[model samples]
Target chain A: MSVETRTDVPPGTAAPAEARRMLRTLARGTATPDRLRRVGAVLVVGCVVFALVSLFDGLARSGDVRDAGQRIAVVRADAAELYRSLADSDAMATSGYVAGGIEPADVRARYDADIASAADRIVHAAGLLPADDPAAEHIKTISQQLPVYNGLIETARVYNRQGLPLGQSYLDSGSKLMRSTILPAVDKLRMLENEALSRAYGEGIAFPFIVLVLGIAVLAGLVDVTLREQRRTNRTLNLGLAGAAVAMVLALLWWSVALLVGAAQISQASTHRTAATALDDARIQVLQARSNESLVLVARGGGSADSEFTKLLEKVLGPNDNGGLLADAQQAGVQVESIRSAAIGWREAHRKVREADDNGNFPEAVKLAVGPDPTGSGATFERLDAALGLALDTQRKAFDDNAGAASAALAGLMAGPTVLALIAAGAVIGGVARRVGEYR
Target chain B: MNTVNARRPFVYLCIAGVLALGSAVITGLTPPPAPPSTATQEAPPPAPAAGCEQQKVDSLRPEGPLPPPGQMPPGSTMDTILKRDRLIAGVDQGKYRLGFRNPTNGELEGSDIDVVKMIAQAIFGDPNKVQYVVLNIADRAQAAADGRVDVVVNSFTVTCERQKLVEFSTAYVAAAQKILVPTASGVTDVKQLAGQRVCTSRGSTTEVVLRKPEYNLDVVTYPNLPDCVLDLQRGRVAAVSSDDIILAGLAAQDPQTRVVGGALDEARYAVGMNKSQPDLVRFVNAVLEKGRDDGSLLASNQKWMGQQLQVVPRPAEAAYRD
Candidate 1:
């Protein structure tokens, strides 16, 4: 049984001849015990291979989860913050313009804050992206054009102080550049970051196909050896065989549990990420509406700015108040009930501002648009912004926590399987070696 | 961070605007370029047509005494506007001295705004009861024709081409198209600007004159001449061509730029109305007649345009062709 195949070594190979000599000496024993050593060798190799595959697979999944949680999340945050701050700066600048040459101190401070935040986000986003990443180019473009936009805005302010209409023209130029160039760049960067995030997420919780197959093979091989031992010795219990079988079952069970828990956590993180994205989009729309609202008065009803303001508001709140980005966010499980109401308030205030301006109540329009009043468009928009900001923060925290737990689910997954596999291999060797010694 | 100097954005905006408007003014404290040469505007022949009996400066005659405020004649345009509560006047907010919105108070000020008020006062007796619709140079006639506004008064020049679209009022202010050039350009006359790029507001009469093959000038039109001033400062064009009043506003904004050359063509500033509203035209003309008689029109002009234009003359006498 040990020498089941014909001796087929090449004629002039000393290594093969030496291997054969050793094989004949080992094969001189009875068939049953010689076969036990052969079966054990095959089982040990199977267990060791399964352990190696599990270790590598576990490490890969853990690495992907970590990357998603830290590096990808930070870059994604930078992209989203860039968008928020840029839109905020435009809205504040236009709204503050309605306050006239010498803006209110608080309005000025808010505008300054928006600009600083935008600049900071740009620097952070640029630093985070790899040099060769496509998003880096968009960041570069945004950084370069940001100053040009600021220069134009400053020129507009100067013109406004001097009571010149050229100030509005310069302001329009600045706004145009922001709309056409800088904002779009941020959009592209965000899109790229989102793709990277999705990729990391997919890898972090992917099914362990190769590891599972190897694990199953090891279990079946161990079962075959146990059956053979039982038949040869007429004893159902071989403690060594029983121990190896327990270790094999435990390894597979732990692997299954870790994979299931990690996948569940990743799915939860994805849901929160989706809801947060909707809130981000809705917030940007609100900021854009606020910008156009004041700019209509700034341009004094020229161009399509007034209509644009209306359209932006409608997109955020929906034309019939039944569906829009806010509604969509609500459907996605975000708490946008407060945002919707605040947006409606802002819309009402914006309507009054337009009415007052159109009806030649210029001072009243400016007051309503950029208010010290509690119910003005400015204040209403602020409330809505704060609400959206809070919602976004909650969603981000949920995503981060779930992602952290996903990586933690994979903790010890690699070492536990490898250690169990090593123990299983030792038991197989010991069990078969004792059987072979009895035959000798 | 931008790592900018300690200067605040407000100061930066002011400096940048000053540089753009008068790039050389702050650099060397260069004296403001010489005030534009005063030349009386020349009126061109009306656009020829097969059988049109329209005149550039002719309008309906004022009939009887003025209608009292809030008690306009029934079935009249003034009555329609009165019912609407606020008089809608189409004016440009970018015309600095004529109809600009004051950045200080967000109030629409300037001489053209005063004209709108004059009409508002006639209808409502409250000069502030006006809904200002900011129209571009191209939209002026369309605004009146479509009844989007009861009157258009943003330095609106009378022309036979526009006559086909909307009714006109007697000339309230006389202006002319002129050349505006950079001080350092050393180019003064319209002839010198021939073959060089010049900017005019889109749908402005200056575009027509500058586009003439004989002038051989490259004409570029913008939404407003004040916008053209941006182009001029950036050296995008050799000069800007528009009504003297508009050029004056641009010049005031940017002292480094100066209005030059004699009047290229004449323009008569008048209120525009829906062609179907002859009564409205007559009513507005009567208001202008009163302003001219009381010297208030000239007074408002002096207040707004006197500094930029260097001379504020009395408005022309009314002409009726009804």
Candidate 2:
């Protein structure tokens, strides 16, 4: 085997290796600043491009957060307006009912004003909302049904004045329409708005972990490349490139930290505090309005108004204390204690009114319902309404404060990132240009 | 060889780094699809209570043969009441004189209250045994049909539509549709109230008559006749329209207001029962006939109303024979 084996090598391979070695030796012999500067320029430009891209992306993300927050704030405002309009409408119904035959002029005017305001708010909300949004759909459904409900009320009023038994039927029908259709739609709208708000809050306050990581990575890469270049080439420092790298890293750190702080503030204001309180207060107001309506029916009789009211109240207010029918009695008591007391006073007034009715006292019941002394159910209802209004105002203020905080926290956030990123790009370009000049 | 040495490691590292970065970016950018949200469950259907359907059927039955004057058949309403050991009747709990609740006692007592008691006496022979179910005007007919109550005596006006659903006994009380206007209003009649707002309780015959173009009143309907009265007082409406009996009740309740218009239409009051219960209907008719003939009805009416009522006169032949 040793005799037959032969080591075959290409004739030019050794010669080529020798030539490459000679070239390497010669290059080392003439190791000059020009070739080193060319290599440094190439590396510097590549790093600068990567850093600039990362900075731009981070800036864009901040813009997205700010935009999301604004959208949520707008929707929240719309939800508030919707709630107010519905509450005002409920008040009007009571006022009109107590005023006898026709609602008082002022009451009617107030009713009209509420309706108009609600319509206007719906229009504005619709414009702001995407057509495909669920909230928009709810708004549309409410808008369509509101007119029908109003028409039914008008018809009921007409029949009632004619002394027709059907008047009661019409009025009952109208009230049913409101309960079944309009109110539920309002609830849906509120829910949808809340959803939008939550989504915005989430987007606005998203953790900046990704941007932070990228910033640290780029900074590390710059430091490593600089140290390597300095050690290998025996250079003291590449001042222009070092300055650009430092400027870019500092800008990234500053922008990222500021954004993180803003995001945290927004999360606290919008997600944790304002939204939850507003929703709770809104729900309470809805329950109170429903309870007031039920009490009216109880007085009417032949309507199972009391029983129905109880059932609905149970559904809305939840189970009562000591397992009684009025479980939420305490909450209701707190919210409308004055109204409850007024209800007691009204009952006394009603007793006298009933006696008068027995003595042929139609006028007496009418007088009791509309008495100016603030002792009637109507007056008590007004007091309860006032209380509810105060609660609503408090909730609204909380919402505004939180929403404003969330919005304000994001202020200058977008512009700051964009401007810093631009400055970073300028530094990177300047650093690369200085290296290129050394190559020249 | 030098070029290959320089390019090979860089190309491999670049590929590996790009793949890792690509995967990370894709994972971050595309969120997982959300799980299907549970929808809010709808409220469970209301319990299938016994009365609603039964009441509808009873309210639809055609009138059968009239009972012999003042004499009920065997196993009639009176006999059934004795058998069941309970008397159930529908009444109102809102009408002041007709039927109103006494908050002090949480008991319903009024003229209509007395009438139901009389029927109870006629049936179970004890008025106290009568179980009164308060119903609105809309539910009264259905309540009768559902057999939830043996009779509906909720100031129900007899009408053709109601007759189609339930068997009505002979009219025990006569009433007419009338307008209740504020004393200050110049409007006196339905004709004079054309284009003027008049309020009435819902589901009452008053709504139907007043809204008719012939009456031409700007009719307003309310959930209760009381609401209509309130509207009239507030001047939201010019008058309140409803059955004259209700109007009379209203007037009696308020001396400041009165039924200003003559009856717009003749309305007869009858006790309603399910059409399926012909024997019971016959018995009720017999009790009513006897009560009228014996002046018990007259006395009860006078006691509660503090005045005379135009009781439906018996047929001329029956009066002559008697």
Candidate 3:
């Protein structure tokens, strides 16, 4: 009846005694309506802020994931266009040779289109990336150098048109520029984009742990407060406050568990499976395409044909040696071994074609390899394509799975936090009102 | 309670602000330095002085006070032939009569081939002591600069700028730049080819001449004259233009092609040596002078090149100075 009598017994109290008295008073419910309302407001505000921050963080991470995906797409497109340009150039050269000097209009058109498309994609990619990024810098360098290379090609074309001896020089200079500068830059850009993608994946999946811990802590604190209030009040519940607490706890639990599961699934699908596999496949595809094209050029018959082709073939298919193309491919750690092996078979087939060509047996080599019957470089290209396709498929699946999980884990999480926080506010307010009513 | 409680939020704000400021300072003040392995080092000091030596041959005193035989510059034609056991001189592997590669052995053999061999003979006293270094049209200058070859004698036309980097003996072959076109193309001169594509090999003086505003022809460049001819036959270009001798060789190979223009510019081919090696230049000039006087030059020209053009004239009397 007189819990207030402790006021006189507390003078000169020991520290533990003081703490115990304070605890007992708290247990006895000195909480007034206004104080309860104030405390509830603070708790509600804090939870809401926390929830909003988590939502923002998740959204930011989602942005990173999206950006990474887009960048990869751009890179893939650019690489494809570059490959098309190189192939078209080779085709033009062959056609021109066969025609004795005149490149077919269609071949020229194809070459032009490929160059234009590659340039457009490079420009678009540059726009997409920040100026400071290495990929952007590389794109800029390529863009600047393209005109110089084109100038040389134009000079060659003009000379060829005029039946002049200098056309070969122009073609040679242009080819050298492409080999030494543009291609290397593209390679570097691809590597940079891959790095960016990895960073994005990390950002996308990083917040789950922090959110889980915070959610659990807040839920536990609310529950403890509710039970203590009930025990002191000698009531089954402060109905309003109890309802709010229950809602908040449920929402928190749901969000935490749902997000954890979703995040795990996304990590498994996107980071662990899809992106990794896709990147590997893409790299291999690039290598195969490049090697195939180089082989075609090196094999084009002339003085030093055998030696040049042999050197290039060895570079493409041989074991790792410092500064060798094959060594670089290995360092890239793509599926290069199988690709190289396939290249070796292609090279053998190409040699047969060359022999046939040299022996004035064009139809035989063309029929045996590039023919519709499927036997030569054409078949090898198809095989390489299939391998790349498989790799791409595997990585794409992985990406989708991880992204889906990440996105799903965050599903309904934003709403859950807000609702729970409001409920907690309601419970504290209601508990204080009940106490106030009883006193009155 | 109202005033004190209001002050509490402000205190929290201040604390948060301080923490943020501290974090910013820490992050902003320090950045890790790039590792040494990642840093690009200065390109190794351009090969030692042995790679570059002073010209010892006095052009003014062509016959006086010349270095004794076999005492040429360290990296001269003679020194290189002896050291590498092969002559590494630029020779045309495309020009059939001048210097074309023998398809069977891939060895270059022709008039120009004989010239390089003569240089080798002069150096090692053995005409067979030569290693032929094949160079594309664009690479001749670079090959010489990078020390890839001892000299560039691939019918190289001497130029003033080229003289700064490499020394030249007395002009051995005289030719002129000309335009080669299809006999059916009706192009007879540079004037007729205005606005039309004229092809020339890169790094050749022909390109420099064609690209000049005076020529006003759309200059197309190829790695070699053969490619230009190929391009011309394909109608990818309107004409193939290069030195008259090269054009003549192209014309000879393919009956459909012919040199259409008179000499666009006279080019005197000379033996190129590293500019720093004057002693070697003197040795080469001495041999050339001897060949000129003894009629061996004429005999070799007739034997290898199939024609006697003109022997280089000897230096005439001039006012002597101290």
Give every prediction's interface RMSD.
Answer: 30.6, 10.0, 9.7
Q: List, residue by residue over A1-440, the lDDT tens digit for candidate 2.
A: 22222124355566665665555543443333433333333334334444454455545544545554456455656666666666566556554654445567776787788788888877887787887876777788878987876776666556445433333434455566666677777766766666655665665556554444444444454454455556755768766446645765765665656556666666555533343343344344444444344335323432233344344334433453122211233333224344334333444554454444333233454465455657654565456445545554554565456556545545555455445445544554565456446644
Instruction: Assess every candidate by TM-score.
Output: 0.82, 0.57, 0.55
Higher-ranked by TM-score: 1 or 2? 1
Q: Rank the candidates by lDDT, best first.
A: 1, 3, 2
Docking class of 2: incorrect
Question: Least accurate stretch of 10 residues (summed lDDT) in model 3 chain B?
Answer: B313-322
**What lDDT tens digits, residue by residue, belong to model 1 across residues B1-322?**
2221112322333343344335334434846346346467866533422334665667788877688888999999899888888888889888788888777876788889999999999999989888788887888899899877889998888888788999888988898888889999998898887788998887777888887788889878777777787778778999999878888888888889888999889888889899998888889988888898888999998998888766785697787766
Please give the lDDT score at residue A310 for candidate 2. Answer: 41
How close is candidate 3 at the interface, in terms of C-alpha RMSD after superposing the true interface residues? 9.7
Output per-candidate TM-scores for chain A, rounded to 2 decimals. 0.88, 0.70, 0.68
Predicted model with the maximum DockQ: 1
Ranking by TM-score: 1, 2, 3
Least accurate 10 contiguous residues by lDDT in model 1 chain A: A1-10
Ranking by DockQ: 1, 2, 3
